[model samples]
Target: MDWDKLRIFHAVADAGSLTHAGDTLNLSQSAVSRQIRGLEESLNATLFHRHARGLILTEQGELLFDATRSMAQRLDAAEARIRDSKEEVFGELRVTTTTGFGSLWLAPRLNKLYEKFPDLRIDLMLEERVLDLPMREADVAIRLKEPSQADLIRKRLMGVNMRLYASKDYLDARGRPEKIEDLSHHRLICQNVNSTQVSAGSTYTQELLTYNIPSLLTVNNYFGVLQATLNGLGIGVLPDYILADFPDIERVLPPSESREIPVFLAYPEELRHSKRIAAFRDFVTEEIFEHRKNLHESGDT
Candidate 1:
């Protein structure tokens, strides 16, 4: 019930050691231990099971920890709202997206954003796992599919398709396939069919594999696939959005491609008024527009 005690308990539970929690809270280990004891006495519950290794949460501890975690997230959200100045776009903005898109596309274009808001701090999280926006796990997300979470604002950023590509040197060495059936003679590089990815990409890879290709190199992510293709290893199944930045790579069997995968940018409804969120949203939207423009001018379609 006491805010300070709850805070201390959360820290101790998180660190799993009184000494470590003391270090974080700027208190002596004895003081932290005293607070924990007091909290347990107040609630008549054993919060942690002491052991040689460290402290493990008891059943009651787990429940209290969950509540404390929720409180911490809400406090963080409130602090973020307070720090978001109406006229200035500065402070940390956490963005999450797939490794392929984040590395190949968004990361490269971030320089322009920095030039505009030199004081802005961005934490870019690249992975296949979808972070929870409403819980403040991340401030914004660019996902391969629509977010089903409630009380969030979503926007469709763009559409992408999985297509075959290889570096000029690789295509020249192995020869390019004129049709889908000709893939039988070439080594195929792609994401592992079982790896976590958009259904469109996985289904496309499966279809390509059905060609009975003799040689194959599978990586769990597209960055690896791109690297292998760049090194003249094999033709790779990759997203079409990569063409804007990597013009040197040639599309193989242009007629063959995957179904369209929708790309969406989303943030919690609570972040609607945050200037940091607004700046980031506009920056990404503008970059996508420019990306589309570049692709059109180059006749890459």
Candidate 2:
């Protein structure tokens, strides 16, 4: 019931060690232990199971921790809102997206963003896992699919297809496969079936494997597949979004592509008024517009 005690308990539960929690809270270990004991006494609950390794949450502690975590997120949202009142996009903005898109697409274009907001500190988290925007795990997300999370402002950024591509050097050296069946003679570079990718990409890879390609180079992410293909390794199944930055790679078997994968940019609805979020969202939207225009001028269908 005490907000200060709840805060201390959350820190201790998170760190799983009184000493570590003490260090974070700027309190002595004894002080932190006393707070935890007081909190437990007030609720008549055993919050943690002490062990040689660290404190493990008891059943009651788990429930309390969940409540504390929610409170922490709400407080984080409030803190972010307060920071945004300065009307400056000059603070930490945590962005999340897939490694392929982040590295090949968004990361390269970030220089323009930096040029505009020189003081902005962007923590770009690149992974396949979808971060919780509403919970403040990330400030913004560019995902391969729509985020189903509630209380989020979602925008469709772009569409991508899991299409086959090969480096010009690779195609020249090995002879490009003209048809899907011709893939049997070439090495295949793709994401492993076990990898965390959109369903469309995995489904496309699965369909390609049916060709019974003799040689294979499967990586956990598209970035690896891109590098391998760049080195003249094999035909790689990659997203079409890479084409804007990497036109040197030639599309192979253009008709053999996967269903469209929708790319979405999302943030918490609560972040609607944040200047950092506004700037970032506008930057991304402008980049998408430019990309589409270039694709059109280049006669891309």
Candidate 3:
């Protein structure tokens, strides 16, 4: 099989138009059409059904597409591995992490790493939703939850303690809630507009108490919640590291009462041998573990 022709087919299928595929592949539309025709003749199957809107994949094309996507991804990974072998910490490192961790901690530390390895390029993708590692959506991920998927290689970074905190102004205005039961009287701020993980028959309201807050103002992102809490909107349940820099916000609850969120550095098991991933994993472990004290002490916990 001609891999080049197969690549052109894949590109056309992806773009849904020969002209767009040609634009992507830096070829003429007629050239792209010729390649597709050649691919169909070679396979002896009609890969696409032409419609007024665009080319729709035939059944055979769908099957071929599934296989081709996998093949292309593996080929790209193989190329990346070879490129990584030829260099020392030089290549794009795509990483996904939560907003709080990315902004407060990881973003700051990455500068030092970049300084040490100038050749390396880093892509920090900050989002609450974990990227799909098995599908190769991201090269690496720093997550708060343990990855249970069999194909992922996960390393525990540290056990992060999440505690309730409030600015002095908010605490003074609403007064302190000495017990968990007293929380009802004060306004609480909840982060992440959508609930984390809803179990069977659970409502949106039910998940709030799971984090130990009932009535509250909810924000869609972590930074919004942090800023709102700092402005004395209400008490917020946040990771200890996030509150480290804000001296005005005091920990409302003891460490024993807080929730322990485990942090993990995860990558696909297949890419475990990649030098870039190994370097990042080791760098994160060394940097975070070595400065664990400062991270903890910076917070009220």
Q: Pick the candidate with the highest lDDT.
A: 1
Candidate 1 per-residue lDDT over residues 182-258, each given as its tens digit: 99999999999899999999999999999989999999999999999888888999998998788679889987899
Shift in Å, residue 69, candidate 3: 0.9
Of 2 and 3, the candidate ranking higher by TM-score: 2
The C-alpha local distance difference test score for the whole of candidate 2 amounts to 0.92
Predictions in order: lDDT:
0.93, 0.92, 0.78
Write candidate 2's Cα lDDT for 89-116 as tens digits: 8889999999999988999999999999
How accurate locally is residue 167 in candidate 2, as Cα lDDT from 0 to 100?
96
Q: TM-scores for all candidates?
A: 0.98, 0.94, 0.84
TM-score of 3: 0.84
User: After aligning candidate 1 to the native by TM-score, how far in Å is the CA of 241 from where it should be?
Assistant: 1.1
